[model samples]
Target: MTADREITRRHAGLLDRLKRPELDVDETDDEDLRHLELRRVVLEVAELDHAQEIALVRAAVARFGKAGQA
Candidate 1:
């Protein structure tokens, strides 16, 4: 798979995990660490104002090209 597709897949997976009510994952696992880290980031991002969110989206799109399209 292309890198863009791979990244999209991973992002979808992370969001899926975030939506779950509870995580039964093992804390020592590297993948679980990533999930937890994403949770932390989401909590922090939740505090951003509308303009900050727009700017963040713009920057992310500039780098990842709308879901990592090349």
Candidate 2:
């Protein structure tokens, strides 16, 4: 595939992982590892365009903020 397609696929995969229902962001024994994973993925995704960065932030907020709902 083309480079742009690959980047788009990577972005989609990252966002899907971020929003996956099984993603445990809770404070567990592996919290450090989880943090490192998130940091690594975010840095990788941040290298993409500004629009994608914004989408990533929005998707993260939507996914993580669901716990606060009534």
Candidate 3:
């Protein structure tokens, strides 16, 4: 697999992990921090120069909104 593909895979996996109910809690400081970090990873992965990855990131951000935001 290529670097772009690898990044895409990682991004998708992270998205899947974020979508879990356990990760959706915003009621605690720890949960908020974890959510922020996960979102940071998502945007970082989205910065890659690939069309598919860009689209994936767009969809994710559209669905979840930007990182570091409550």
Candidate 4:
């Protein structure tokens, strides 16, 4: 959603008042931001595997190899 529709976690407190708003009325701004940041870190880490062949890429990391330029 755009900035105009953004709702901070604090905004949720308003829901308990007389004018109760729709449950999950709007997307959680904090959760959305955290999700985005997490996605970015996961993607960058995946790209730094440095394996030329998919077969060589194992789930176990042997070493903390040099971090490649993002």
What ranges in model 2 sit over 4 Å off?
Answer: 1-47, 67-70
For all predicted structures, in order, the TM-scores are: 0.26, 0.26, 0.26, 0.20
lDDT of 1 by residue, 1-70 (tens): 6999999999998898775586676756866567568665785657777888899988976887556653
lDDT of 2 by residue, 1-70 (tens): 6999999999998898775477556577576666578666776656787788799999888878576774
Which ten-residue region of model 3 has the weakest summed lDDT? Answer: 18-27
RMSD in order of candidates: 24.6, 25.5, 26.7, 16.5
Model 2, position 14, has a per-residue lDDT of: 87
Q: Please list the C-alpha lDDT of all candidates, in the order they appear.
A: 0.76, 0.76, 0.73, 0.56
Tens-digit lDDT track of model 3 for 1-70: 6999999999998898774465545468766677678665775656665787788888987868445576
Taking all chains together, the TM-score of candidate 3 against the true structure is 0.26
Which stretches of candidate 3 lie above 4 Å from their native place?
20-70
**In lDDT terms, how accurate is model 2?**
0.76
Instruction: Give the true-structure RMSD of model 2.
Output: 25.5
TM-score of 1: 0.26
Which ranges in model 1 have alpha carbons more than 4 Å from their true place?
Answer: 1-47, 65-70
lDDT of 3: 0.73
